[model samples]
Target: MMRREFLRGTFGVAGASLLSEVATGLSGGGAVVAAPKSKITGGTIDLREFHRMRRFADLSMGRIAYVERGKGPVALFLHGFPLNGYQWRGALERLSPYRRCIAADFMGLGYSEVPENADISIPAQADMLAALLDHLKIDEVDLVANDSGGLTAQLFVARHGSRVRSLLLTNCDVDENSPPPAFLPVIQLGHQPGAADKFIAPQVADKNFARTDKGLGIAYTHPAQLTDEAIDCYFGPLVSSPARKEQFSRFLLALEPNLLVPIRSQLKEFRKPVHIVWATDDIFFGVEWAEWLDRTLPGSRGVRRVEGAKLFFPEEMPDVIAEEAKALWGVSRSPGGSL
Candidate 1:
């Protein structure tokens, strides 16, 4: 069944109203009233509670929106483009008990309030993350990322390797594979005025439309299950205002240049433990790239390929991420935790 239909059948009026309020509040930058304290059921996090979890850090770049849970050593989660910290909700739900999990929306995407002239390039994103860590007084973190976030994570580790205890990367740009050919059209369209709005606004309006191959559905394994609330949470902010659209466009345009090639030597020199969990079916970033990462990195723990999964599989299959992360940290489910 379509996720929207399921939501209607399951929640009826009040639940739908709550979801609407959460979406409206998050997208419109208004207040969400009477949000349920706990919105996690099974592994998914409710949009309302996800909004409530948001904490902003004011830096020179902008007000960075993030969410954190648990109490222990730090683990930072970086999401893919056109997505926010909300993508890691499932992983955070599962792994927060063992480590303090943080998911920060990048400068342009999600709820991060950046200036009109803010440099939302990948390098600037790396610098922003450093400033954010400093603001939080965190010396180091176990870094986890997917898609473009993987690219930023590599740059982050290259620039601040000492600050990262380990690394977990999913399907994303790597070395010469940076800004894969499939993404060229997006960069092209992003350079044009109002093009991003044409692409994203419709998806936000119709949950099912967002699941089409033309939309973000191509990135997910189960596109039909992509929820209405998730669609609004992910795309609403990008189209909320003219300034936001410009920043989102800048984010894509900035990625057109190859930023990863210059860091190849640095990546090779990064001696921290690195684990790669790649989705084989991802057209943009293939498993060959994962193999390339394994061969390139000196401290690589090797690559684990998930057959038939797409680019955003980490959101759908958080268990794989959790398992790889625990293995990388050498921790397991036990009463005594915090490694």
Candidate 2:
């Protein structure tokens, strides 16, 4: 089903009214009323609670949102743009039992705030992440990144190789010169004044699939399973902040030019063990990018394709990511080799 239809069915009028109130409050005219907290289900994880529950560290650009759970080797998760650390909700739950899991919402996304006139480029983001790690007193971590976060991960490893134990990338575009076609318009809009508001406002309500919501729905895995409350939890933040929208636009535009130079200079120098996990049917970025990344990085193992998954493979196949991460870290049940 389409995302709009699902929202209509699940939220009805009352939920819509709540969303309206949230939007109005963000505009500074209405008194903000905290919504009643939803009950947390043990079986199904909620990233909103994870974000809301944590205390954030003030960074160079903004307040960095992060959560640390469990113990052992640390695992740091970085998410893509338009989305936040919430993208790792599934992987965080599955992997939390094995190791310390750290997930952060990048500036201008989720609960994190973007300082005025701050640089939201990939390198800056990598620096912010490093700063966050320093603040948390973490010296090393196994990095898992998706989409644009993948680029940030690469920058981190390139700059500070000793800190990374291993690398896990899922459905991210790593090539500097080649970016997805769907991203071009957004990038262009970001460079132009007021263009982001004109372009992104209308489409924020709908599923962002090129063909059908089916492609987008696969990322969630359970289409009918998503409640209106969940949808609101995801979409409300973006609609609430106009500044966030503007910063996000700048972020999109800055990604390509800012990252291209660093990635080109440092990609070959990266010697950490790298694993690329890609979805077979992703419309935004294809498997070709993964192949190129694997070939370029000297320590890359290879690319692993997840069947019936899409761009958001971590969300779609969390178990697979957890299993791969375990194997990559050499923490398997078997004595010393492959399981």
Which candidate tops TM-score?
1
Please, what is the TM-score per model?
A: 0.87, 0.77
Please state every model's RMSD to the true fold in angstroms.
11.2, 11.8
lDDT of 2 by residue, 1-339 (tens): 322333332212121211121112112111222221221223446645665557689876778877766677799998876667666777777777777888898776667776757877777888888888888888999999987888778788777778998899887767653355545644665666764345434434654431123222434324444544544444456556667667767777766564545556577877878888876555556666777787888878877765445566575457677777887787764333332
lDDT of each: 0.80, 0.64
Give me the candidate number with maximum lDDT: 1
lDDT of 1 by residue, 1-339 (tens): 332332232212121211221112111111112212222233546688899899999998889999998878899999998899999988898788789999999999999998999999998999899999999999999999999999999989888888999999899999998898667766776767875576787687778868765578868867777888888889999999999988888898988999889989999898889888877667678667888898989888787776656788888887778878988888866626646
